[model samples]
Structures are given as C-alpha cells and as structure tokens.
Target: MARFKTKHTEWLLSNMAITVSSLLSSNPKPLTSRPVGRPPIEYVNAGPRQKRKLASDLAVHQGHNTSLLVHAAAVSAEKSNEEDTALVLKNIYLTPSDHNKVRKNLFTQKTDSVRLTEDEAFFEFVLKIAYRLKLKKWQVRDENGKKEMAKQKNTIQKKMWNAMALHVDKPKQNGNGNTNDGNTARRAFAKPKLLAEILGLDENLIAYFNSILIAISCHLPIDPTQFKKYCQKTVTLYMSLYPWFPMSATVHKVLMHGYQIIEASILPLGVLGENASEARNKYYKSDRRLHARKSTRQKNMEDVFHRAMDSSDPLVSSIYLAKRLGQQNKLPLPADVIELLESPNFLYPCNMDNNNNAPVFDANNSDSDSDSENPFTIEIDVEDDF
Candidate 1:
C-alpha cells in the first residue's frame, strides 16, 4: 500500500511537470538521460551553480517538488525496509541530466514571479501596492522617464486593496477618449469613498471580498469541498456585478484542479502549497542581488542537499541523517501514522475500519433506514439542456 501511494505520487508529479512544460514551451520534449556535466545555457551572467539553482527554484515554484505526496512517500519509504519498495522509492538516485530535464519542463524564461494562478498574483499585487512596496525593484526605470526611485507614500492605508481597485478600475474618459491628463488623473486618487459608492461597492461587496481572501489564504481548515464552493461563489458574484469581467487562466484552473487535489488525496493545502518554494525563490533573488560572483553550481548542489538532509526540525533531521548513514533506525512514527497525523480526513469513520476484510461496498445491502448511513455520500442531478 505504501509502495502504491509512493508510485502514484511520483506519477502525479511527473505528469504535472510535463503538463506545465507543455504549456510554457512551444515544443516540449520527454525527459531523457544525458552525459553528466554542467547543462547547456544561453547566457554567461553567472557560473553553472547559479544557473542550476535558479532552474531548480523555478521548477519547485511551478509544482515540481512542491507535491506533498512525494514528501510523504519519501518519509514512508524511509521507514519500510522492504527491498522492492526501497527500489521503487529511490528517486534521489536520478542522474543530474534527468533532473535538469524535469526542471526545464517545470519552469520557463517567461516566468517573472512564481504565482502561477491569476487570483494569487492579483492578491499579491493589491497587497504590495497597499503596503507601498516598490514595484519592479530589479529594474531602474518608471513611466515618467526619470531616474527617481519609484517610492510613492500612499496616504490612505487600506487593508482591502482588491475591493478598492474594483471601484477605481474603470475611469471616466475625456472627449478625446483619453484620461484627463492633469486634475482628473489626480482626482481619481482623491475621493475614494465617493468612487466606491459610485461603483456599487457597498457593505455586501466589501464583505464578499474579505470572505474571498479568507477562502484563498488557506488559514482556515483545509477543506477542499468548502474551498471549491467559496471559489465558485466568489466568481459567480464577481460575474453578476460585471458580466464582462475577465478571469485569469489560473483562477479557472483552480476551480477545476485545485480543490480536486484535496478531494482525491490525503494531503492538505499547507503541505502541498507553494509558500516554501516562493520563499526559497525570494532567498535566491536576494542572494544573487547581494553579489555578482555568488551563484556557483557546487553551492547550489550543497544548499539543496543540506536543506533536504539537515532540516531545522530535529525529528526530520534525525530521520534523514539516520537514513543517510544506512542505519536501520526506527522512524519517529510509522509511515501510516505520519499520514494520519498530517491529514485529519483519514481519521473519519469511512477510512478507519480495522477489519481486514470489511466488504469494499455492500451494494446489495441498501441501508437507508440506518441512521449511521454514509453522510459523506452526495448526489446531484443535471439537465442535458435548459
């Protein structure tokens, strides 16, 4: 069973990597073996180490090693001494060549920020603006064609930037069909309350926007069904307000794929999330900016290995070092127990039967009369055409 879960996770990660590569590249290629050495690169901005680190970081942010399933499998496989299972779970044995191919597919040159979904990126934009963070800090130019640093002090500090942006998104145009150059442009920023009222941003709209933020933030319990319903409701509400409202591809994909990930698996959003990967990218960017000659291939390799094998968590570090030292040390807890600890859904009665042969499903025994019927079972009817 552990082997099956591990293999299933690997397959999902592989497929996700491939799908993302196909989307980003015009011509995606299958992963293949190649001679070991520094992989080919078009630029010499930094040495091979920086290139590898950058590539790996990009791949991770795009859901390559971001799968909780893979991590769980790795943990589970370390506990089980079964030779066949060990062989199947030996992913760390991947040659550098194959690993490079996986990274290439999972990331692309076009990627500026790691926010793959539209909604996530949108929220980030709003929050950054609200916090008065300078945009395009890497670049040294603004629209006014001046050398001035782009740091504008926002007098009005608002917590709900997304909600506010909606009110001011559509500006009134002059007779020439362009925004008024002088006073009109400044007035838009002056009276925000009036504009909010004009745009129908009442108490209800503000509440809805707040609710949407809470839903996507994943600060609440990791319930995919509830999350999916929230997403659908928010989208529907937005559409009703403005029928021609544009939605990002990422938003659409979230409704279709994001929630189902939780529904069909034991992993929680926090475990399978992009926060760690995103934070890692930020670290890389900061490190690179601090110096020019810092990104070496050996440095990249050492950093990754250290992060995996020498974690800050004592339990993780202990188990990883034990596995590395080839000692038959018992895991902190059994692999199955680890899964149960990480996921609350598994503790439910539906999955907690102790019987070895608890008939998979008693189809013949219709027990609608029983009060202990499967409360989880849900059904809905749909019409072919309305």
Candidate 2:
C-alpha cells in the first residue's frame, strides 16, 4: 500500500541520517567495552558476517588495541631512509593487518569460560539474575531459540525494560533555559537503588544487584575504597548464593583481580577502551571498499598520516616531533593538564567519611547489642513501602 511504502521510506531516511551522524563523530575510547552489559536482541539474531563484525569490534575494544600514531610515524620515517631504491615503503611501519592479528589473538588467547565476548558475559549475567528472580515470562534467549522467534510479548519484561532505562530521554528545555522537570523526576531511575525501589525487589535481591552493578561498572564516580569494600562483600554473597552459575565466575574474577587490571594499565580505561579502535575500523572498512586494490593499503596509510598531520594543533605537532626526535624531556606537560590530573574532582569522588561506621538498621525491632554487632541491617519499612 502507498501508506506502508511512505512509512518504510521515512524509516529508511531516519536510519540513514542516524548512520551519517554516527559516522561523522570521532570514535573516542569508551569508559567500558562496546556492548558493555549485554548483547541486544538484534545483535544476537544477526547473520554470520554481522555477528563476526560485532565480535571483531568487541575483540578490538576489549584488547584496547589503539593504533600507536607515534610508533607508526617512526616506522614511516625509518622506511623512507632505507638503502634499497626499488623498495619504497608508502605505508606506516605497522600494517593494519598486524593490529587485526592482535585483536584476533585477544579473543582466542583467553581461556576463561566467563570471557564469552563482552555482550555474552553480560547477557549470561542478566539471564542468571532473571532466572533466580522468577522473571521468566520474557526470558533472554539465543538467536536460534523458539521463544526468540515468537512474536508474543510479556509484561514482566516490559517492567524490567522500564527499570533499565540507562539512557533517559531528558525533557527539552524551553526558550527561557529552565528545566521543566524537577530533580526528583530528572534523577536516573536506572540506578540500583531506584531499580530496586521501582521494581519492588526484596532487600536481599537489592543488595545482590547493587553489588553486581558496582562490580560491572568500570568508571562510576564513587569512592574507590568504598567501592572495593562493597564489591568484596556483594561478590562474596552472590558467589555463595550462586556458586555453580557461569556468570558467578565473572563476579569471582572481579573480586580477585578486576581492580588491579586498571591499575596496571598505562593510560585511562576510556583512552584505551575499544570505542576508538572500532571507530577507526569502521572508517577503514568503508574507505578500503571504495579503494580496493593491491596498493590500497599504502594509499590508505598515507591518507591517515596526512589527516592526522592536518588536524593536529601546532603545540601537539611540536610535542610529537620532540618525542619522535628523542627530545621529549624538553617539553613538559602543560600546567592545566597537570592541575586537572591532580584535582580531586577529575575522575573519582572523595572517600565516604562514615565508611567505617555501619548504617543503622530498624530502630523499632533491634536490641542494642544486635544493632551494634550488625550495623548493615536495613530497615523493614523500606521493603514494606516497596
């Protein structure tokens, strides 16, 4: 029908516009991996090539395999001065294929069964929690599953979807530039506290999900010390409750080694995370397709270098040249950069003042001795209200 055709055309245009906007944006590194929590239904049901591309992006991001622009420049410089006249090296010293090999190795090398790609681990975790909670009406399913193919929808899953509103649609401000919604309504309901409150989860379930959320979030602005303690307690409880579950392995791993992994890295997690790599991969793929030939690699490399040089600020160019020429000591970090790094507000929040003191339990039910011993016991009325 004409009406159906018009609707389809509108959908196509909207999608094309979105794609173009995404393409124009720089692929900055993420605070966490792409497909951070779980694989979307569409991604799960995608064909082989689509799935492979998703996996490839995850691998690239997980490994934090950035193109070392400085190193690439060094390679190009050295190759140009080679004695062999016939052997002209147009590309940077490191090939794009070399980066791909490293990314491939990241997926293949890890032996941990819990490492079922970025989204898979997240999906498994969500499924396990949902199963335990008796939220099976709209279950997370595999691509090939009958349930996944079925069109019938469930209400419980709809409620859960509302609870997981991570990216909220903020109300548009008027010409006066004042927020229409108050702070209470504007507050993110996706947080564990709100999710527990809105979804009417029990105290035990609240504590369990709270811990899982803390462990999973790589860059929450909470105090690291309190976060570590909270993570330790929650992970211990979750593992005790669901020791046999595969996602428990992920929680267990986080308990043992997750905190130290970030500390060991040279750059911030956001800088090295997969977002940047995947973005470059997308650009390269599109450009390579257009310029398909034996010499394409060399041509592309030259293009990348030219773009990098052209876009770079004068100060950045000087610093790059200085570092490349082994005069890095001559250029000290800018005062603003140093000040920003040293500022307490940069990435982490200040430590909790009363972290050692446990929160008060129900004032009505507890004896003095009981209250003193287990201060973390939450009030029963909180559950009653929920």
Candidate 3:
C-alpha cells in the first residue's frame, strides 16, 4: 500500500509538469479576438440596420459602374432647368406621399428652376420642332415683320409662329385659349411639379407638355436631302441612349417619314419596301449581271443584326425578309431571332463559283454555270460601291 501510493504521487506530478511544458512550448497563442483598435461598441452599435446601411453603400458603388443606367439618369437630368435640379433631385428620392410637401417646397423655391421639365427634353428630342422649323415664307415673319425664321434657329419668335400655325387654325372657347388643337405657344415654361406653385388652376402637366408640343408642329419643312444622314445618326444615338423615353405619336410619325425617305433613297432605290423573298430573288441571285447579290445581302444582314441585337426594341430584324415577316405575322424564334439565317457558301465567292482559274464545274457537280461568274466585273462594282 505504501509503495503504490508513492508511485501514484510521482506519476501525478510528472503529468502536471508535462502539461505545463506543452503549454509553454506551444508557438501561437489561441486567438481570444480582442478588439483591433477601439471596440465596435464605441462606433455604431452592431445591429442589422448597420449591416443594411453598409450593404446599401456597396450597392451604390456598384450602381456607379453600371454606365448605361447612369447615362439614362444623366439624360433625365439634362432636360430640366438648372434651378429645378435640387427639387428634382429631392423629388427623385421621394415617393408619392411627399407630393404635398414637395408642392409647398416648390413655392418657396426660385422661379427659373420651376420652368422646363420633361417638356424641354421632349422638345430637344425632335430636332425640327425644338430647334429650326422651316415655315411658309408668309408664315415665317417675325415681330419686326421680316423673315427671321431661317437665320434665327432658336428664337422664341420662331416658336410663336409655330404656335400660331397650331392654335389659330382652331380657336378655343375659353378666352385664355387653353385647349390644344395640336398647337400652342412655343413656350418652354414649365411650372412646379407640385400643384401649389401652378399658374393655372387646372395644373395638368400633360397639358403643359402638350403646349410645348404645340410649339412644334407637322408643318415644319424637312429637307429630305440634307437632313437624312443627320436625322439617321441622331435618331440612332437617341434611341440607343434612351430606350425608356416615352415617344409621342407625332414623333413616331415624323421618324417614320424620315425612315421612308431613307428606304426610298439609301442604296439601291426602293429596296427597303420590296418583298424580302422577291428582293432576294431579284437582287441576290448568283447570276445577277452586275454583282454577287448574295454577298451584299449577307454583309448587310450581318451588320444590321450586330446593331439590332444591342437595341432594346423587340421588332429588330434588319434582314428585309425577317422585317417583313415580323410585320406580317410573328413566329417562334431564338433570342437572336432575326440574325442572318442564310449561308453564302452556295453563293458565288469573289465573282467566281467553282474552279478558281476556270469557271467550270467539277466532275462531281452539274450546276456549273449557276455557281460561277467573272470577277473583274465584281471588282469594278466594289469600287463603285465605295
């Protein structure tokens, strides 16, 4: 019993010494997670709201990287008066419940900022209306009784003439002439977005926009020759930049007319309106005397699809047949539905079909003449096209 007790005591002391030595030998101390600098409790108390605020800041940083959405926001801002931006910015962050507060706030704000809201944007969009509008020589008279409409592109006098052509033709019963017969004074003035600062009791924003619309009219003479390229580039850029902008019927009609001019005149005259299959048959046949019609068709289709794929519109078919098909009846298709569906391999390459040197079919082929053509003629055409 005495011997066993002595052994147990020796073993217990040895185990404790080993444990102490092991702890001392350990390299990295266990991390107790002490505060790095000041405790977070000294900052905003750690909570779900702090996490959410941090998340919102991160999202805003991401939003800045989204260039297209930022471009849209910039375009929306560009249409307003310098004075109204603060209100616009404030209202932009606000909801419908703040309407009364915003109205009261506008009354307290400066007047210049209160003028020209989206109407200015809409006006600027349709160039002929917003800027230079050609009028009848008799109709182009200024307050000085001279034809200033041609030289004075952006004068209020030009707007007045446009407005007269619009409103006087159909007078309103109200002495104030509030009714729109498709025309009103070319005033860019827009009142406060809220009701309290309104000059008119009715205070319909739509009416105000229409009055600005009336400042522009269908009578504006569009020079088909000079303006076609300008209009095309402008329309393409505008549509590319602002897909969300609400288009008025008048603007659509005008743009349609402009498109019609391009269709009638652009490359091969009257090519755009032709039936796609008919156009393909008439223009793209391998044996077409002047050129390889299929080659041109394929190139045009490729270019148009590349452009239209990036467009926001659903009705995007640059190919004549596809566009016509869309107009006639819709069909099941891919996401890139209207891309080039035809292959040009069968179409004669470089104005030649079968054998490189000789325009003869291989023993394996029978349609020799159908596959081949002379290239010297094709080369001349390409230069002419350029």
Candidate 4:
C-alpha cells in the first residue's frame, strides 16, 4: 500500500513537471519521453535579458507550491494517524491521469453566471495570484521596494503603498470585459509568520487564511464562484490527509464549522460508483427517525456499522453494538445475526463462522478483485473516470 501511494504521488509530480516544462519552453515538446537530464534549452528565443529569468522563475515557484502541498499532506496524515481518522491512504492514489488533461479543456470556460456543474475556476484564479506574488518576491522587489515596504504604517498612504505590492492574478472585474487569471495581476503581500511551528497551527487556520486572502483580493473579491473553489481545496486536502472517510454526518459537521463565517451551501463530492445509492442507504449501523433519516455504505460493512453505532443513526446500531461487544472470539453469529446478514440488502456480514478469523481488508488490495475495503466508496470503472 505504501509503495502504491508513493508511486501515485510520483506520477502526479512527474506529470506536473512535464506540464510546467512545456509551458516554460519556447517550443513545447510532444508528449513523449527522452532520456533524462535537464531537457536542453540550448536555443534561446530572441528577447531581452529577461528571457534568462524563466528557469529561475519556474524553479522558485515550483519549489514553493510543491513544498506547501507536500507538507499539508504530511501534516494531515500524521494528525489522522494519531487520532484514528477514517479516510486515510485511500485518497492518496489518483483516479487516473486524464482528469488533469480535462482541466486544460475547461480553462477559459465562462458563463453569464457561475456554472453549478464546473466550479474550480475561482480557486484556480486565487492560486494564480499567489504564484505571482511569490514570483514577484523573486523577480522584482528591489532595494527601493524594500525601502517602500519598511515605510508602511497604518495611515491611508501606507495602505495605498502596501496595496501597491501587485502580483499575477486575474484582473479586477471591470464593466468592460472579463480578464483571465494567468494574464492579469493583482495587489498582494507576503506577511511573514512569527510562529516557529508554521504547520503546527491548526489545519483549519491554514484553510481560513487561504480564504481570507482570497476574500480581500480585488481580483477574487467575495464571489461565490471563488469561495466554492476555496472550500473544495480545503475539503480535498482534508480528504487526502485524514484517516477517516467524511461520512455525511462528519462532512456536515466539518463543512458547517469551517464555512459558518461565509454561510454558504456546497455541493457534495461523494465517492462515486453504481452502488453509491445502496451505500448511501444501508451501510451504517445508525438510527433514523430520531435524528434525520440517512443512508450507509455497502462495502466496509463493519466500519460503516461502527460509524452508525457511534453516531445517532439508529437503524442497525444495536445489532452492530451487539456484534462488536461479542467480537473478541466468536463463530456463527447467533441465528438473529445470521438473519440480519441474510437480509435481502446486507451482503457481507461479519464472517461469524470464520474462527479462522482473517483481517477484514488490507490497503494493498485496492485493485483486488474480491471487493473494495472502503464502505463509502463507489465501484466506478477508473478508466471511465480518467
């Protein structure tokens, strides 16, 4: 499993490197590999000395972006492991690479208003802004700019001067026309953190800062489209890092607490597959009428059942409670348990008779034919997804 996850990350990194390398090149290569080294940039396109700066700019930007994302994933994994979170390791693998290819196709797509179906545009814009700021800190910001920064104070002039720290981002939405994020620039600043433990700050804090920065930026301003992208990045990062699957209950809580300030509604990014409907219905061992009627996953029956028992979902909570209590060493679940498993919907009951007692699932078996270990996950044809 660890090996699989490592290779998965490697592929993502490699593909990104390829894309960036292409963009930086005077003549981008066809999607093919040559024996490695640095791909030669022997021929220079005619331009000012500024042309020489491309390699330096690309390196610094990639380093900063890659470092933050890598650390975020690491911190997430460490925290979840310490606390026994649910959605661990499973999200580390890619759905397949074509999802990224589809991304370029969607760039520049716009509408009179935001499209509910495809909404990553806003956060992408924010990222473009942040990247430009980092680049500015490298490419520009001379001694004079430093002096100007040193002079900043709370007066209105200071505000204007501070706001002069413009970086690459989408242009302001003027009455004339729209501007693309990559082609425009926006005011930005680099606030130095005094804390010794940067990542040590709460993960939610990291996400909030990301959102607040976007909210204040004139380019992104407080638009719903941009806000949704911010939420998606946070949620995706959490899913990729945490050990537990964010069930509807937990998902509701996390999004609720995180977005409370904004008072926004978000579409769910549920695990996909044909059995998603079934998983939603009968997977967990929780009550219904008392709280709200809810569903469950079909796979990872034990895990879902456990989640239900822990939450208020009442449906099969008691049954699960009984099984776990009696679990240490048991065989044929008493007749009642057998009847429950035999119920038309419930498939894999705890293998009561298997005194042989096998471990339920292993991470390495992600593609194993037997079955998926994640109860909440859908069995989509990964190829189709890609």
Error of 2 at 335 (Å): 28
TM for candidate 2 is: 0.33
Model 2 / residue 369 / CA error / Å: 57
Predicted candidate 2, C-alpha RMSD: 34.3
Cα lDDT tens digits for candidate 3, 1-386: 88888879877566443356766675957769766895454214657887777656655867744444434444566665444554555454545467677688877534353222233344433333322223323233365434444344435334434543222223346643222321122332322132112111123332333332322221222234433444455456545534444455545544435436434543422233324445455443333444323367776565554443443234232223333433553222211111111222342122333432312224344323243332323233345655
- Point out where model 1 deviates above 4 Å: 1-206, 219-221, 255-258, 278-304, 312-386
Model 4 misplaced stretches (Cα beyond 4 Å): 1-111, 116-119, 131-386
Q: Which residue segments of model 3 deviate by more than 4 Å?
A: 1-185, 189-223, 259-386
lDDT of 2 at 211: 40
lDDT of 4: 0.38
Q: In model 4, state the lDDT of residue 75.
A: 66
Candidate ranking under lDDT, highest first, comes to 1, 2, 3, 4
TM-score of each: 0.29, 0.33, 0.17, 0.16
For candidate 3, what is the lDDT?
0.39
Pairs of residues at least 3 apart in sequence or in different chains that clash in candidate 3:
84-113
Which residue pairs collide, candidate 2?
A: 61-274
Please estimate how well model 1 matches the true structure, expressed as its whole-model Cα lDDT. Answer: 0.44
Better of 1 and 3 by TM-score: 1
